[model samples]
Target: MGIFEYAPAPESRAVVDIKPSYDLFIGGEFVPATGGVFKSVNPATEEVLAEIGLASDADVDRAVAAARTAYERVWSRMPGAERGKYLFRIARIIQERARELAVLESIDNGKPIRETRDVDVPLVAAHFFHYAGWADKLEYAGYGPNPRPLGVAAQVIPWNFPLLMLAWKIAPALACGNTVVLKPAETTPLTALLFAEICRQAELPAGVVNIVTGAGETGARLVAHPGVDKVAFTGSTAVGRSIARAVAGTDKKLTLELGGKAANIVFDDAPIDQAVEGIVDSIFFNQGQVCCAGSRLLVQESIQDELLDALRRRMGTLRLGDPLDKNTDVGAINSAEQLARITELTAAGEAEGAERWSPACELPAQGFWFAPTIFTNVSATHRIAREEIFGPVLSVLTFRTPDEAIAKANNTPYGLSAGVWTEKGSRILSMAKRLRAGVVWANTFNKFDPASPFGGYKESGYGREGGLQGLEAYLDV
Candidate 1:
């Protein structure tokens, strides 16, 4: 029997009413592709949720041609205020359909319904709304006397935060008067397709926003297509490097928001209970599929044992099951491949002499599931400590001082984000300055706002994704 067999299936009528077979959204219409079709599975139950068109090279060409034509004839020439109005319309439509979108996101992407409803969907709408305000105010964004749009942007987003990432990519591109051909990751493509419909509902211009769904091959074709003027990606560090090489000599402007193994540092002066909560939320939210998850927990030696005991006790209480449940704290792993990767890395941590611990809880049999795991006594050289596990796995390492903690946190090549927990305000500021990350959260972890700029430093990839900085990625300054 499957894990879900022990409980009643959650309500799915909101997702069921929507058509499951989706095609390429091109020229403001959903049209069948001339190539192949693939089925998208629900990770929670290993059930087929939908069949989506897999774009062929020819289909990519057609989409690019349409985007280019739109850029040259309609999009680029559109007034900034008009572009702003269109984004506002889309944002309003998203707000109207927020519940439906949340339900679909939970079903298609395996994120908890509470998070999809309260966090992802709301933030997705807010991102569009915030960037909409920036459309006509380019001059105020400190870009110089004038800013011009990049002709056509090709974006490929990851599965972790599907619709939200799509919003981050598309809203700014469209607000800057650039047409886009976006490819959503294969594992979670339905929300992008649904957003395409929302665009149609808002009467967005034909070819202004096109979504092509497929795996890596389609994304590569979209990014490397000669007609595309810009490329934006959010995924693994390995693929980000490949994309950098792929676009190397081309004039295609590139922005990559790649992988991260962020560190959450808890000093001796920190409020242990609050710090523990933030640490738990940082690493376990989205089942730790988040790239910016605080997978590395650095605690002061004085409180390491106390914090670990508290964390283990808290993790033991977390309920993991159907994503659509209003009460579920942890959901199924996104895919079988992801589960295997987590399993492999967890074993590596144990092999390398780190002690592994998981809560005594039952996992669902049907879907890809992993218990929230932590590795104590982890060294910086352990594969589990160094690699991006991309699951609800935390590696605990102790530090003796603030300088040591900062050194240990910045030890990795990734500099996307980090967190510091302390009651000392001066220490927070000092540590934030010394840390070489793009985003530093003081006394908190994993907080996001549409008004805040977000991205990475070093190998975590370049360019900003939110706030005023995001508009620059789509514009020629």
Candidate 2:
């Protein structure tokens, strides 16, 4: 059967008001940074979206101080129900401004509008609403009688799910009554900056939430500052290590969510069609920028041939183009550096003797992009199988038994997440229990919820980021 063609259905970017230059959001106000400014670009067309303030050492210190002041005076002392009210307002504002946030996200982050609008933006609001309900009910969260707020929290988020990660860190912290100083990734700061406006609209107090923007040095300064009572970060494992070394022996409490090379294990008995769809969404969703993306596909040897055929056919149909286009299934990569990384890793796969395959797809002339790629004949030691490519690249390996599948899937240095596809109930339970990953999805992939706790074991980083346990990250137990 031939694939159907669809005309371009671009989303209107008119909803977004891209400021030519944006300032640092500090202490309930948008203030100029003491450091130099940096330009943010639309990765889809390589257009300069806006210039953003780069937070200096002094700027980080000031933001931290502002959070401390807010924590000690207003935010920490505010009644839990009152705090919930503010979170409720922020959640509502996010809903009202959903289209605006979604358009800006697609423009600034180079992700498909379908993703920013349907998945990322809604989850952003859902997180706030979920945590808002918990704000007034901390005592019932099973964290003992009176869990006190840890005061100022220093949070750093990655670019992949800019606003969603912010909500993940900020929501629970706020629910537990901790004021925060957050640093959004330098490349994708627009949505976070807009979120600052939401705070203002919600009448959230100054210093309650401060957003600083800069590169690694700024993040290092923010996390290492003595004024911050707690630290939460979601990014690469290398940076997580640096933050860990910095926080070691300090009084500050810390939580980190880092890299992953998750395995999507498909058994012979699994529903072939459903598994194929799950596999595609696992890696290609968000252009495979997800940390817990199923980069490694382990298929049962018995059905390996059948599964690959279906998966490739599905890959061929994925649309890749302008992120503003609703029809574009795969969009531009987040940045040039990220594109280079993906390019290099895929090259390594070819060199390492893994059979590389990608459907014939035309890439846009400008901006960073990668065609959805897969590798068969991949050995356990292949770099593509072992490394976290963090792009729409999947490496396939075949396994004979359930035990072998578990062994191959657990071989990675990462233990962030994994998926098991099977019809047998006992096999699913057995495989899930044996998998070393922190999250195991049976018969599904890339599914998330605000109520479910998510994190990783081993090098993928420590502690949880959702549910009641997430609340503990910001509390003094």
Candidate 3:
């Protein structure tokens, strides 16, 4: 659909009262951090949205101390059912203020309002709700007769899906009876700070969930804090390695959900139009900031020309503009730095002999933006095929057989997720089993659920996030 097909209906920013400055949420209160202050920018307009407090080493100490005290005296000591009630309250509050939160997320994180409202916010609530039911039923969760909370959990989340990633970390940790000290990415901290208010509204006790906001330094201190018993991080692989080294000899139980260069394999018998839509949704959703985005397209040689033609036509219809607009399909890049990385990699793809192609789309000149792009004639050795672009850029390579597709898909060191598009049930099963990925989608991509486990293998990091299995990440048997 073109922009003219649907009249422009932008969601109201008036719903969100963006404060001039925000403080660290620690001990169930908004406290000042000693780590100085920084501005959080709206990537869509390059506007200064809010002044965010940076968390210093001492701030990390204070936050971890608060979490430890809470885990020691209050949260972990509370009955599981009571903890569950608190979780349920937070979930309801999220739904109640969904519009406000979605608006804030769009401006701060640069994802479209349609996505923030429909996917991110809803899934965040679902995560909290899913974990709440498990609060009183940990015993039956197959962990043990009595799985214990892992004390204070230090969680660090990335910028791509800020609020949703917070839900993935905090909900289960709290539901499992652990107190948390969370550090949201510096670039997108508004929704997380708003979530702190939701905790207060839910009457969650002081020191149970603390948020310390800053850049990489803040996250580093949080993960390395001595009082923390468990560490869960979601970001880049290089950062994941540093965390692994930091917590290597310590007793801290750690789970890392890092990067991916996933493959979306399309077969000759697959539904062409349907696969094209899935492919677009896979890479272009959230401006392709997803960790498990289908950046690599492995199509059967017989259907290559047919699929590419349809895919190009579909890409042309993708509307790129204001994030708050309901009609927009692609939004701004998260930051200038991230846009630079995408630009450098896409340029590399072309330099390495890949044919670069993008629909005729004009980007707003004010803020960070990269047009939705794809590279054809890409080889296995091309940098674009091997590395995670983490943007709306797809690399297309052809395969003649299922085995070739499998080999091409698993060629990368990062095996977080993959998609198989085929009509044959037997082919789906066979390909899914053979693909070296943590999550395999038979006929779809980018589908997530609170009940299903999501994580990756290889350098994509260790451990699962959303499911009964995720409980173990925060509990001690």
CA RMSD per model (angstroms) = 2.7, 0.7, 1.1
lDDT of 1 at 242: 94
Across 385-477, the per-residue lDDT of candidate 3 in tens digits comes to: 999899999999999988889889989899899999988999899988999999999888999999999999999999999999999999997
lDDT of each: 0.91, 0.94, 0.94
Q: Cα lDDT of model 3 overall? A: 0.94
For model 3, what is the error of residue 98's alpha carbon versus the real structure, in angstroms, after optimal superposition?
0.4
Candidate 1 per-residue lDDT over residues 202-233, each given as its tens digit:
98889988888888999999999999999999
Best model per lDDT: 3
What does candidate 3 score on TM? 0.99
lDDT of 2 by residue, 1-477 (tens): 667899889999888899999999899999999899999999999999999999999999889888888988999999999999999999999999999999999999999999999999999999999999999999999989999999899999999999999999999999999999999998999999999999999999999999999999999999889888899999999999999999999999999999999999999989999999999999999999999999999999989999999988888899999999989899999999999999999999999899989999999999999999999999999888888899999999999998888889999899999999999999889888899999999999998899999999999999999888899898899
| Candidate 2 accuracy as TM-score | 0.99
**Which ranking of candidates, highest lDDT first?**
3, 2, 1
Total clashing residue pairs per candidate? 1, 0, 0
Candidate closer to the true structure by lDDT (higher is better), 2 or 3: 3
Misplaced by over 4 Å in model 1 are: 1-12
| Candidate 1 clashes between residue pairs 3 or more apart in a chain or in different chains | 3-365
Pairwise lDDT winner, candidates 1 and 3: 3
